[model samples]
Target: MAQYTFRTRSSDCPYELAIGLVSGRWKPRLLEVLKDETLRYGDLKERLKPVSDKVLSAALDDMTRNGLISRTAFAEIPPRVEYALTPQGESLLEALGPLRDWARTENGR
Candidate 1:
């Protein structure tokens, strides 16, 4: 269930205040993968390397619903499909900079 919070100023739902769309365990990893380029479903699943089909499918649906990612389908005999991040999602790359800086500053990796 979704939790509720109140704003004495505007009184909006926390769902709208979410941190730039990527959430849950698999999502961040998915974004990391997509940062390079658009990819096919099989390529993503292979890069994720152990995620189950059901979990990945659900994650993809969630991202698409949140407007963080785009899915394109092509009309080929085999049906080509690819996934890429939206400009909104691309904007989040900068927001995650601090964490990357911290990881390097602390872990030295």
Candidate 2:
């Protein structure tokens, strides 16, 4: 994956920054899945079937690094880890509503 740097410049477009944040193949889908509820790693792996373990782990790490998601780990016999969207992530999802509507309308749904 290519590294992206978001610079705070007057000429920098906010749209680009937003797009960069959710630019991965699995990111938007992951956000949608996380929108409804907090899920464990295994649960997410199961829900997003056919997604390889390495790719899923990397995507989760990237999302977490970008502040789009939160990871919580619990100490137990088997260990527990959960993922959920952050406030910024939720806001991003809400912002996607219009885009979603536009796509649906374009598709004549």
Candidate 3:
């Protein structure tokens, strides 16, 4: 069975409530892509080619619902919707910086 971590301040889980907000493969990747600029749905699909549309949609929806990403709608001939990270998401990205550095340096990535 797929298990989720539910931890308190003293709980055994290494991360806190914040990390749990982005506890999936595509979540981190999605955030990484959105760190510098906004991306549209098709852009996301193109950038994350290995991920299926269904999985990408689910991850983006989850992030949006969790106050991580913002979805903007524009009235154009074909319509435009862009996604960007919210302040909370930006904070999360900052927090993960050190960990990302460690992962690259120590894990030889």
Candidate 4:
């Protein structure tokens, strides 16, 4: 486990806590991509084409800080790093299913 300073008062409200965990430009999209398998930084960036490096990096960092994702760095001459959902993040994805279904219903899907 690691400690971090949250940008919001997450401990004060459940809504804030939930939002703070996943609200960002590319968080939901990133989560969807990571739901199935682990991916290296380059692979993730490729899958998330059109997302600038800065944006993706920030999103990954925020998610990592919140315990939503785990980052594994490998030692090698050319470094390799992989990102995957943590248990908490998998739970978040499971919780999102109903919300997604609701949105689809609203959209008449």
Candidate 5:
């Protein structure tokens, strides 16, 4: 696994910081999936079919580090892990509503 750091200079725009956090093929989709429900690793992997384990893991790690998602691991015998959006993530989703709506309208949906 690679190490990802979300770095921002003092002059960096707020939009750039926000975009940097969620800028990825899987990050946005991962956020969408965790928007309403908490799911296990396997469940998330299943929902995001065709996504490689490496990419999925990286995305989850990045989101976790950025404080957009929370990861919980249980101490059970077999081990249990779950993922869900954080409050910050929920706020981001709300902020993205206009963009989503614009896309929907553009697609005539």
Candidate 6:
């Protein structure tokens, strides 16, 4: 399985590249909204309404494959699954805090 990384490009600023890694239309929202909790697929889909099922699935897969999120599958009569941030993901969220704050103030939110 191929994994994603921000270091793939050599010419870009490291910070910019790092920021770009989570710059997908839904990725930053996913990370921010999910920062405080673990969520099942259906719950996530509901919370991220307006996003197509295919796009959400692809974003989750990319984050999971890249080690940013951990997916737990439960075996039951009906299978259940959940997603939560990994240590790396938590750290990334912390790193984005200042940027988020800056944006908020700049936009007068």
- The numbered model that scores best in lDDT is 5
TM-score of each: 0.76, 0.85, 0.80, 0.87, 0.87, 0.83
Q: Which portions of model 3 miss their true places by more than 4 Å?
A: 1-16
Between the candidate structures 2 and 3, which one is better when assessed by TM-score? Answer: 2
lDDT values, one for every candidate:
0.76, 0.84, 0.84, 0.84, 0.85, 0.81
Ranking by TM-score: 5, 4, 2, 6, 3, 1
- Would you list the clashing residue pairs of candidate 3? none
Candidate 1 stretches with Cα past 4 Å from truth are: 1-16
How does model 5 score by TM-score? Answer: 0.87
Tens digit per residue, CA lDDT, model 5, 1-109: 3333343222246676667777878888888999999999999999999899999999998888778999999999899999999998898888888888999999999
Task: Compose the digit string of candidate 3's lDDT tens values, residues 45-86.
Answer: 999889999999999988898778999999998999999999
> Model 1 scores what on Cα lDDT?
0.76
lDDT of 4 by residue, 1-109 (tens): 3333354324656655676677776898888999999999999999998899999999999889878889999999699899999888898888878888999999999
For residue 105, model 6's alpha carbon misses the true position, in angstroms, by: 1.2
Candidate 5 lowest-lDDT run of ten = 2-11
Candidate 4 yields a Cα-based lDDT of: 0.84
Show how many residue pairs clash in every candidate, following the order shown.
Answer: 0, 0, 0, 0, 0, 0
| Local error of candidate 6 at residue 28 (angstroms) | 0.9
Of candidates 6 and 4, the better by lDDT? 4
Query: Where in model 5 is the C-alpha error above 4 Å?
Result: 1-11
